[model samples]
Target: MSADCLFCKIVAGEIPADVVHETGATLAFRDIGPKAPVHVLVIPKAHHADVAALAVTDPALAGEVLAAAAEVARKEGLLAHGYRTIFNTGGYGGQEVFHVHAHVVGGAPLGPMLSPR
Candidate 1:
């Protein structure tokens, strides 16, 4: 993990967050700035800049993140209907934070607002 990374700090417990769930390899928390009623983010404890970078050498970790995301969506009560798992990569994809995180959004009508802002 990069020492200067914000997500790393949150994973290390140096920073406080509204954590919803966590495991040995991952951490799930409410988005500080949520866009939906059930907006949560699941991320690996290790620091990865983005999903594209994560897939290059850490496919297993990538799988873990995705699996955990689905689990959180179910746990957060979005399974019966539906939810969206978004991983914005790079600046063009709206990845403002240089950390690989899965956004599990639900509990609302997510019709046309998913496009890049």
Candidate 2:
């Protein structure tokens, strides 16, 4: 885990977060800035700068992240109704934190996936 990464800190227990789920390879937590009624961030335990980095470095771990995201959605009671999973890759993609994480959002109609640019 990178000492400077926020998600890494949370994984390492150096930081506190509203965690929702965890596995040997992944961690899921509530987003501090929630966009939906249910918003969770699912991440791999190992540090990855972004989705691309995670994919290239450890593809299986990347899959684990996705699986964890689904689990979060299910646990949040949005699975049967459906939900959206998002990965903002970089700054241009709207990624604020460097760590690779998936946003699990649902619990209500989310409207359009994105606003018109």
Candidate 3:
């Protein structure tokens, strides 16, 4: 984990978050600054840093994170219609938080994607 990453701090309990779920290897929480009504995030507890960094040797760990995200989506009632999951890697994709996270968003109709503010 990077020394100054915001999410690493949260995972370390050095900061606070509206955590929704936590397991042996991951944590799920409500996104403080949400993009959609039901937005939430699933992150690896061990701190892998970024999606671009995932590798074949890490497949099992990576699968755990994805499964945890799906579990959170189902629990949040976002499945009957559908949900959108995204990982914004690095700066170009708008990853303000450096710690890798999967965004789980959807419930009601999203209407339209907002233009970047």
Candidate 4:
């Protein structure tokens, strides 16, 4: 784990988070600045720069992250309605944190993936 990575800190308990679920390889927590009613961040406990890095270097861990996202969505009661899992890669993808993570959002009608052009 990188000493400077925020999500790593949270996974290590060096920094506090509203952790909702956890597995041997993954951690799920509420987003501090949520974009949806059930916005949660699912991350691999191991440090990865981003999703692509995780996919290339640690695919097993990446799968764990996806499993955790689905678990969080089920626990949050989003499956009955619907839920979306997002992975923002790099700066252009809107990834504020460098760690590999997935955002599980639901609990309401999210509507369009983007505004109509």
Go through the candidates in order and give each one's C-alpha lDDT: 0.90, 0.91, 0.83, 0.92
**Could you tell me which 10 consecutive residues in candidate 1 have the lowest summed lDDT?**
108-117
Spell out the clash pairs found in candidate 4: none
Alpha-carbon RMSD, each predicted model: 1.6, 0.9, 2.3, 1.0
Q: Among all windows of ten consecutive residues in candidate 4, which has the lowest summed lDDT?
A: 58-67
Which tens-of-lDDT digit does each residue in 69-97 have in candidate 1? 99899889998888999998888788887
What C-alpha lDDT does candidate 4 achieve relative to the native structure? 0.92
TM-score of each: 0.94, 0.96, 0.87, 0.96
Minimal lDDT window, size 10, model 3: 48-57
lDDT of prediction 1: 0.90
Model 4 lDDT per residue over 1-117, tens place: 999999989988999999999998899999999988999999999899999999999888888888889899999999898999999999988999999889999988999997797
Error of 1 at 3 (Å): 1.6
Candidate 2: where is the Cα deviation over 4 Å?
none
lDDT of 3 by residue, 1-117 (tens): 667888888888998989988899889999988878889999988767677665344777788889999999889988898898888888888887777799999877776565667
Better of 1 and 3 by lDDT: 1
Query: Could you tell me the TM-score of candidate 4?
Result: 0.96
Candidate whose lDDT is highest:
4
